[model samples]
Structures are given as structure tokens and as C-alpha cells.
Target: MCPPEHFTVEYAINPWMDTKIAVDGALALKQWASLRDTLTDLGHLVHVLDARPGLPDMVYSANGAFSVDGTVYGARFKYPQRAGEADEHRAFYAEKTDNWRFFAPEQVNEGEGDFTYLPGAYGGIVLAGYGFRTDPAAHAEAQEILGRPVISLKLVDPAFYHLDTALAVLDDRHVTYYPEAFSPASQRVLAQLFPDALLADRSDAEAFGLNLVSDGRHVILNTEATAMGHKVRAAGYLPVHVNLSELKLGGGSVKCAVAELRP
Candidate 1:
């Protein structure tokens, strides 16, 4: 079983999001400590990003960028208010690990939360959720850059604006997603790719419950979704739930809290 404290964290400081549910100083600190404790228990290398003063809700936007093929492609967010986030990540990319690279598209595209990797034995496929975060052209650009096929889909729900917020494919064949958020065309494409995807119910998804981290039969999920937690366990995978309600208000969850660097 993988423990919790093994993750490396890089979070943005945001007071607006925090105060939404009254996530103030002590409350925020306690919540972060809980998250850190969970990560440590999971055997992940945790690294907390230094809080950037005057930055309001940058962590939520960070979920858009993802790391793939040893490169970290920063996101181009839709909200103009989040434009500065791209530059923030650019600086982080430069000073951080050399293994992390950057991909900035002149066109608009949100990165990781909008896209999920389908790692296959032969090669890998990427599912880009289009509409709010990722543009159709961005999917094509990403495919060209990665030299792989990127399947694009329309993300229907406002609450589940990003792909990660709606769906999570854990094992090679098993996937957890809110069916209502996907279009028929996208569903057909997904069937072509993942023939037998397990769908997650909507109520659980709102809590960022369906966003999962997996290592083979082992799965990591947010603690808030007790029903989904039961489902994951029923599927025969060891489930590790970490409480991150504070982070969720910032538009992120457990999946966004860490960048997985190992297979």
C-alpha cells in the first residue's frame, strides 16, 4: 500500500476562495496539515509551494496544467483574470526541475484538468474535454506536440467544467466519470478507446470524489465521497481517501494536489 506523505505539493495562495467557506488562517493551516499528513502516509514526496502574497486563487488554475513525457505544459486559462497564472507557472518551470518542460499555445487551452492521459501498452491516448477550458485546436496542437492521438469532447456541465472534475480513468480498462457531462459523440469515441468504462454518478463528482489516483489495483480518492469510496473498495482496489475540502473550494482536489512523476 502506498502511503500519504510521499507527494510533492505546489499550491497557490488564495484568500477569496479560502474565505468562501471561512477557510481562514488557522482553518487553512489545519486543512493543509491534514493534506500533508495524508500525503506523507501515502509514501509520496510532498513539497509545498511557498505562498505568493497578493495572488488570489492561483492554485485552482494550476489544475489546468499537466505534466507528461517529462515535460510540464503550463495552461492558458479561459478567464482573463487568470492570465497572470501562465507567467507564474513559466517562472516556476524555469527555476524548478529541468525535467519539467513547458508548452505554451498561442491559442487557448487549459491543460491537465481538461485533459486526461490514457496510458496504453502500445502507446498512450489523451482525452481533451472541450468547451470552457480547452479549445478544439488545442487538442490538435497537443497531439502534434506529443505525436499521438488526442480525442476531443465537449464538456457539458458548468460544475464539472474540466475533464478531471467529471471523469477519471484509473486502470487500463476501468474509468470513472459522470455520463451526463459527456456528449453522445464523445461517448462513442470513448467506447472506441475504452470499451468498458465504469461510469461514476453525478452527486459524487460534484465533491471531486471521482478524481482518483491509481497505481495498479491501488486507488487514491478524496475522503468526502463516502459512496464512491465504497465503490472503489468493492472493485477490489485498495482505496486511500484524503480530506481536501479546503482545496476543493479553490477549484482543485486531491488529484490537483500532486504531480505524479512515477509509474
Candidate 2:
């Protein structure tokens, strides 16, 4: 996780980012610290990536790299603004730990922003989303890099730009997502893959409710997702609410601020 020390909407990259809108710098920092604390409180180790100047979106560390079993698949951002941030992540990995291997990709893939791992014995299959920030070719490239099957899912909605924005992997066997954010074929594919998956309503989805993190038992989500919270409870997971309104202005919340390293 990286601190929102330099977070701001300098330019509109996604639907949520509006140049006219103002960001509360102090509030964003406070909210980010709270998010980090929440994960630590849950017994999860939190790592910090130093925020670089001219890279405000670096706070959304999930876009930096996708790590699994000590190997990291580095990101290649579609936009020039975030292009340098991926290399910074590789540097962080190089400096912090040497036991792991890192691979810089030739494809335009926004790391965990498009890749969601579905757990399996040997590093599971990756549910990869495309047609937005990630390129379809990145799926095959990521598959070869990670040595895992990459299932391509297409995203059609501009609001739900990244896969993590519209879907939350609840656990190894379960997931929750907003169906409208995906293509009809992708929606059908998801339904076939996990029939019992929790479906987020329009209200919940717009509130960025599906942009959450779950540890199979505990779900960390935004405070505005009341309906999704109830569904999470019904699914036997504890829902922990966190207000990321300041960060939301930049098109991210709990899940975006987090980049899980499965080493």
C-alpha cells in the first residue's frame, strides 16, 4: 500500500476523475492511513511504496504489479502518466526483497487493476479483464509470465474502468460483481463460473461497493454500500466499512489502494 501524499486529479483518466473537482489532500492522506491501519488491524502485513512526484496515481498501488508465489508480473500502464510508476514498483521490489523474481511485461496490462487471481493449488488461474485499461494480448502474455491460465473477461462500462472497480474476489471459491459493468458474454461466463456469486445492484455498484477487499471472512468496503454490506453479511463474511470519499474522487477506494503480494 502507498500513501496518498501526492494524490490529486491532475487530468481526467477515467469517468470518475473530473478536473473541475477539487481533492482534499489532508483528508485523502488520513483516509489512506486509516485503510492501511484497518488491514494491519486484521493481522495483514502492509507494505509501503514511496510515492513519487508527478505520479499522483501511484497511490493506487494495485496497478503497479501482480505478485503470486514469489514472482511478480510488472505493469505497463496504458496512459503515459502512470507509465513511470510501474518501474518504481519494480525498483521497490528489487530494493525490499531479493528472494522473489520480477518480470517486466511487453504488453499494456495494469497489473492487479485488470488481473484477479482465482486461487488454486499451484498459483491458480487469473481472471483477467480487458477492453479498457488492459489489452487483450496482455492475457496471453501474463499467462506465459505467471505460468497460469488467464481467462479473459471484457469490460464495457467506462465508469467501471478497471476490473477491481466492478468486481471483488471474496475468496478462493466466491466473488461479488456488478454484471452491467461487463459484456453480456463475460457476464454469462462469470455466472457459469460462480453461480452463487453475490450480485451488486445498481445503487450498490455506483457507490463503488464492489470495489472492496475480502479475506474470505472479512470484507472491507466503502460506507455507502449498505445493500452490499447486507449481502456480505448474508454470505457469512464480516463487512468492515471505511470512508474513502476523498480517494473516491480519484476513482479508487479500498481495493485500489491495496496490492496483495502473495509471496
Give the TM-scores of the predictions, in the order they appear: 0.82, 0.97
Model 2, range 12-106, lDDT digits (tens) per residue?
98989998988999999988898889999999999898888999999999999998778899999999989999988999889857667899999
lDDT of 1 by residue, 1-263 (tens): 11112122223232213333544444545555666676577676765555444444454433536666766556787766556656766666667665666677666776677777767723777778886667788888787766667778887777777777778867755677777878888777766766666667877887687766776566777778888888778877788777766666666676665545421
Residue ranges of candidate 1 with Cα displaced over 4 Å: 1-21, 61-64
Q: Count the backbone clashes (under 3 Å) in each candidate.
A: 22, 0
- Candidate 2's TM-score reads 0.97
What overall lDDT goes with each candidate model? 0.65, 0.89
Best-performing candidate as measured by lDDT: 2
Q: Which candidate gets the maximum TM-score versus the true structure?
A: 2
Prediction 1 global C-alpha lDDT: 0.65
Clashes of 1: 22
